[model samples]
Target: MNNSPIHILLAEDEPSLAMIVKESLETRGLKISLFADGKSALQGFTKGNYDLVVLDVMMPEMNGFEVAQEIRAQDEEIPIMFLTAKSQTDDVLKGFHVGGNDYIKKPFSMEELIVRIHNLLNRKKLQQSSEQFRIGEFIFNFPQQRLIYKNNEPVKLTHREAHLLYHLWNNKNKVLDRSYILQKLWGSDDFFSGRSMDVFITKLRKKLNQDPTIEILNVRGYGYKLIIPST
Candidate 1:
């Protein structure tokens, strides 16, 4: 059994369900932080570094959608799952719109929940691994959160910068829609996040500018493209 467990943030109101789920996950080597209200959940989230978040849609003080939006504002990469009783199409749409990566309806089986959790974690791991790519004169290690330039020292990157660079590198030489990047990297394509992405792009450009053959071009009225010239 692996001891260094995955930490999960579980926001659910029902005491009985919360305890059961917590015990179930704990038995499987997962750690959980349970909150009965959305407000408390949000507060806890701000203070904790969780691997994934499981949110109940009908929590007190704030609904799952609102809490998800708030969380997405701070973190764009953390996987979010919605555990709610509501099964309406609109509700499902809202869940994903607010940054939910998975949605589990109520009356779910423990086995299924565990499987879903594992699947999400596995996908995230794969993504991180695939994100480590070689750009001209630079080797980006996304998991390590650094860019190694031509046998020189590794330049540490912030979480946002690393994530953004990963996305750009993943779609290298192709035009990446601006809104798509904002949503994928920042969890939202709103005005504030868009502005923030622009700033990050500028920073990344400066960092990668050391290599004359590499350029991140802004696609007029559309998106950005990371161009790596073949030597």
Candidate 2:
């Protein structure tokens, strides 16, 4: 995983609603930059590094669709989710037409919003992940399923091992939920899958133990977190 918080750009005109959304997302461990208008949001997008963009459909100065167009021009892969009250089919189609990745109707639950945001982020990550990753002294090659260190023979990894390591690396510095990993790799989070994950986790730990600075920690009852300083 990257070594920074998930930063979000939010464009909402209503002060109360903006604050509520900001606080709610913050409590869930996200960093939000709130703007009161679409133009200001576009400006923020230009100046700030952000993981995702959430834009309210109706705003002064500009609208969500306009901002999305600008953002899409600048960064084609960044997730753009529209917060709209419009129920008309044309409006929904228009949002997608302007490069909106997803849209939620107004009066959405924090839970639903969180789920959508996670889904978008996950999809973007999978699509754009690099073929290789650096983990402390080791370089991980996802496509080749190999782990190489200094000039020595690379450590060959099984398909499952490579897949797991790639995801762990994708979410390095953040706690990766066990259920999420299980579902991605095993297709279900059943008891058997959980046990299988434990075995793989043990195998990975041993393989990576040569680097003292790198750790795949079991976050107690939650999940695993790969702790490695940026190289």
Candidate 3:
């Protein structure tokens, strides 16, 4: 849609299908690099820069799940979408478990695929905008990964901690839905990632414990609320 091309990494073993998808997306102004195998896809991913990834689930040498996991291990925030013919719930769950941001079942319409990709990229942009947060006389600078107090004392935050806190502080005093948060931060709304988010929440609470006025409240089945007392 936009004249500015989005860099995309496409890992599909089927040449014809890959060509069709690549050409279709390219016509829409997306810049894509196609790989016929998962191994080559990952190798290219490691050596190149891409804004989004479309990985076929079944491939020789390596599978999409493994590749997604490896990518997540290095770049936690890159958007990843899985492409597979299988529509089984377990397979879909597995893709999300491996850090997939979204999944497209095979035989999908090109229109639908493009729409999903646009939505994912737009959502990522919105999240990035909310990375900076103001909370209880302190500013949480997510891009810098530091929390600065009024006195200018900066506290370094771990990757997960910074991301988790940024979301909470961005939605300060407002109820943030758990499912929305899990999907935005962890790239999935699965049980394990939910638990991991909980752990990060706890850690953030501890880190902010120094300022009793700043609190992270669990909304129980709903989500979390960050309470920043007004000075």
Per-residue alpha-carbon lDDT of model 2 for 1-231, expressed as tens digits?
Answer: 566889999999999989999999999899999999999999999999999999999999999999999998887667788898986766765676576766778898888788888977875666456578789899988766689886778997654577788889889999999999877665447665566678778889998888899999999888999999875
Off by over 4 Å in 2: 130-231
| Most TM-score-accurate candidate | 3
Candidate 1 lDDT over 1-231, as tens digits, reads 646779999999999999999999999889999999999999999999899999999989999999999998898778788898986766765676676776777899999788878866865685576656789999998876789998888887655577678878889999989998775654457665566677779989999978989999999889999999875
**Backbone collisions counted per model:** 0, 3, 0
- The candidate 2 region of ten consecutive residues with least summed lDDT is 184-193
| TM-score-sorted candidate list, best first | 3, 1, 2
What C-alpha RMSD separates each model from the true structure? 8.1, 12.8, 5.1
- What global local distance difference test value does model 2 have? 0.83
Q: Which stretches of candidate 1 lie over 4 Å from their true place?
A: 1-3, 132-231
Candidate 3 lDDT score relative to the true structure: 0.81
Per-model TM-score on C-alpha atoms = 0.59, 0.57, 0.65
TM-score of 1: 0.59
| Candidate that beats the other on lDDT, 1 or 3, i.e. the better one | 1
- Local lDDT at 131 for model 3: 61
